[model samples]
Target: MGDNDHSHPFFLHHSDHPNLVLVSKKLNGDNYTTWARGIHISLSVKNKLGFITGDIEEPSSSEDPDTHAAWRCCNDMILSWLLHSLKPELVESVLFSTTAQAVWDDLCERFSQSNIPRIFQLNRELATISQGTSFVSAYFTRLKGLWDELASYNEHCTCSYGAKNDRQ
Candidate 1:
């Protein structure tokens, strides 16, 4: 967990379990939730789910005898991985957070703006969007991207909530 040592072997998640997508170098505008989900699944596979779930409290010092030393180290490693995943511009904002859960919470708060006015504006734009003179395939691609963005923000389109929402 020391700043100078990058030798922590436990931090790397290289297995082919399917849901574990390595954090990308740059997480741009709307990719936060997707990135977070991947990180969560990967961490879960490592039995370190508590690091981001707030179940494991961050240790104040590695020297403290009562601390879960290995967990603390793993938590720091996870936080480091999360830091590496952020876009360079966003790194500064979350850097001050002490624990992985705090960082996760801060990111969720900042990026998960489901009730924001921008969602309404995006909806309006999508409703009025037309192919115009564009090629059919290109138009479809653009439309699909807009729909994906909408689904990411809308919450109900996600599989977890979709079933419950559908029954209502």
Candidate 2:
């Protein structure tokens, strides 16, 4: 993959036939365990900005104050760092899974006019697609209007990161 091309693994329950692309030649060894349960794996689609980043961690119910604080800080730090690195000009409208729609909604509302270059969820599936580009496979098409609104959101983001590049 080139500097601009990145891919991430997205998982689904063993019986779930998710449509997300899987770039791997074969499933990971961990899937062997799930294979006993008949699970398959595939590569996830990538967008201009990058893939919709997701992580799998052991579920925890700990609600300690310090834990929550650290978690929140880590989340912000991750997004802040990505914004610095990828510096996406415009993010696609999100299409998060039902599991994450509320969070996606909050993001859309928070970044509504701000063009920090993030996608918003327009449907139940989290595919990072454009508003209407099949509503299925467009990750950066939402950027169509980026040039028109970037100046306004860049001001909200207040950073020089990826501010001087354009598609050729």
> What is every candidate's alpha-carbon RMSD to the true fold?
8.5, 18.5
For residues 1-168, what per-residue lDDT tens digits would candidate 1 score against the true structure? 443333433343444233223565345647655676676666676666677766666555656644556556566777777777787788899888877787776776666553355567768989999999999999999999878766755552222223324323
Question: Once superposed on the true structure, which residue ranges of model 1 sit more than 4 Å away at CA?
Answer: 1-21, 59-66, 114-168
Give the alpha-carbon lDDT of every model.
0.63, 0.28
Residue 77, candidate 2: how far off, in angstroms?
0.7
Q: What is the Cα-based lDDT of residue 144 in candidate 1?
A: 93
Off by over 4 Å in 2: 1-62, 91-168
Cα distance off (Å), candidate 2, residue 129? 35
TM-score between candidate 2 and the true structure: 0.21
lDDT assessment of candidate 2: 0.28
Scored by lDDT, the top model is 1
